[model samples]
Target: MTNNTPRVALVTGGSGGIGRTVVERLARDGMAVGVHYAGNKARAEETVAAVQALGGRAVAVSGDVADEHAMSDAFDTVEREFGGLDVVVNTAGIMLLSPIATLDLDDLDRMHRTNIRGTFVVSQQAARRVRRGGAIINFSTSVTRLQFPAYGAYAASKGAVEAMTLILARELRGKDITVNAVAPGPTATELFLDGKDQAAIDTLAKAAPLERLGTPEDVAESVAFLAGPARWVNGQVLYTNGGVA
Candidate 1:
């Protein structure tokens, strides 16, 4: 409301690798941020501390992203603490890999529960609450275009995310809010590097023309652009994959 009030943001899954970087980057952008974590209270607080170390304002909020009521409370906390919300980045998601034939139905369901339903729940609240001139950013994956084997189920879930993200952008027309999704490819994170040998990692690393796996900080820069300065960049899926696709 005042010229001096900093912008506010709520980043789901803010304790994870890429999400953690996003939280700090937004804080660096001068936004008072609400770091939302599903179960890792300690890690979330660590992220809060990192932002504080940077001389930024931050708070850690907890909730399952798929739970409507809990996420509602999380959003309320951000607004209450920071005065108003200007950006919401839904980085909360899970990836389960398998060929469509051998894929466990339960695995597909679990991934869908978190990735699809979770995004909807968070985006619903964001649609209702983010102040005018705010932005909503969602996470998808470049695998949808990469068509990599064993990623069928995961890609399907993210495919739905891409669909919903574009539609939400249009639905928010005239509200001065921008809705978009960032699709990262071959990022080097603990979860990503797990179960892979160095040779395999090197092969995938070179798959991109950039000749290296993407880093969380690399992905965070894209988020920072959308959250702060990319006002006209709405309803687009940014493939932050170093031209792998």
Candidate 2:
């Protein structure tokens, strides 16, 4: 028998960018949401309020994705506030771009700490706490396949996400949970636009066969599918790029 209760979701880094759009899309799909943010409490609250303004249920929860205790508490808050978790979208990550040769070790370490370790930590909690028939969607980047020059460290971190995501799907064989990763190409978000001049932006916009940069809404559509339906699409790294790779 199908359950009548509304599914709930916890989106890490949901305060901004793709994460924010993901939260909005999930809420529109009739799920209560926990918007998790690392540092910006106010920003997360804004996302929650926006959802509420649209007659959706949402709550802002804060935590550093890399901190086990913190993430555990965030999950606890979501389960407690929303009744239970039906989906987890680990969108919390950092990107520091530089050619491999001159890349700062500290930057690499910081990026990995959030992008790799953070994904693992969040996925672990989702595995333990998310109810059966739920979904776990992790974020990846097309740069792993695109082989962009300065994205070595960033792509390495995402490559790890892809590997663990596939293994985690198999590991949860009997749980009725689907684990997948969404790898998006360049999207038109504030975070992606930051520091990029118009020329560079234009160049990337034309890189895809679509001849334009992707919008957050474009990426969120794929996430909404993985979170709610598309049950047969499991253990895969879905390249949500518009033919960029």
Candidate 3:
């Protein structure tokens, strides 16, 4: 199921702050992109339009990342539309913060379902369907290393992602596909800045040795490397933070 065709990439959460940047970057890299969105059809359409405006090929696909059948269909659509599947970037995730002692079990379950189970589902499809020479990039967080006080559950979910990423790379032995995770620290995305006050933001901004928060494009660069040229860098987590750890 391999051919010398133009590279194709499917990016989950392609309408998101970081994911949108990744989609555009890959398009600029000359790959046809399938922008997968969980629910935000309008934003996904906007993303597709942005790519098309740039004279790139793109389509918007909708599916829940945690649903095996939905993701399976999403993959099929991308392969059908783009002629083949090459790179898959799973950036669809949710973060819910809570201290361990007072954590709501329901919140934990919801986060795990999206962050852990959703990643597994998407990775499963990527492993089975991505063409040879393809790449599978998953998202983790620097919070796992920072171990922030209220991030216990969120960190646990990403820990599972880190584990699966390494193991899946080994499982795909003999295939030319690369599997890796990108861990971004305090990136300046709506998801990270939504509820934080100026004081909190300032404190976090100074935490990194570079003395500033990272942008979505900063993380997207790491993803771009793994997806295209970083063939030798596999089964590892690349932290895109400014030496925060």
lDDT of each: 0.94, 0.94, 0.95
For TM-score, candidate 1 versus 3, the one ahead is 1
Span of 10 residues, lowest total lDDT, candidate 2: 1-10
Q: What is the C-alpha RMSD of each candidate to the true structure, in Å?
A: 0.9, 1.0, 1.3
In terms of lDDT, model 3 sits at 0.95
Q: Which tens-of-lDDT digit does each residue in 18-63 have in candidate 2?
A: 9999999999999999999999999999999999999999999988
Q: Which 10-residue window of candidate 3 scores lowest in summed lDDT? A: 1-10
lDDT of 3 by residue, 132-195 (tens): 8999999999988999999999999999999999999999999999999999999989888998
lDDT of 1 by residue, 1-245 (tens): 45566899999999878999999999988999999999999999999999999899999999999999999999989999988898999999999898999999999999999999999999999999998878999999999999999999999999999999999999999999999999999999999999999999999999999899999999999999999789999999999999999
Model 2 Cα shift for residue 129 (angstroms) = 1.1
TM-score of each: 0.98, 0.98, 0.97
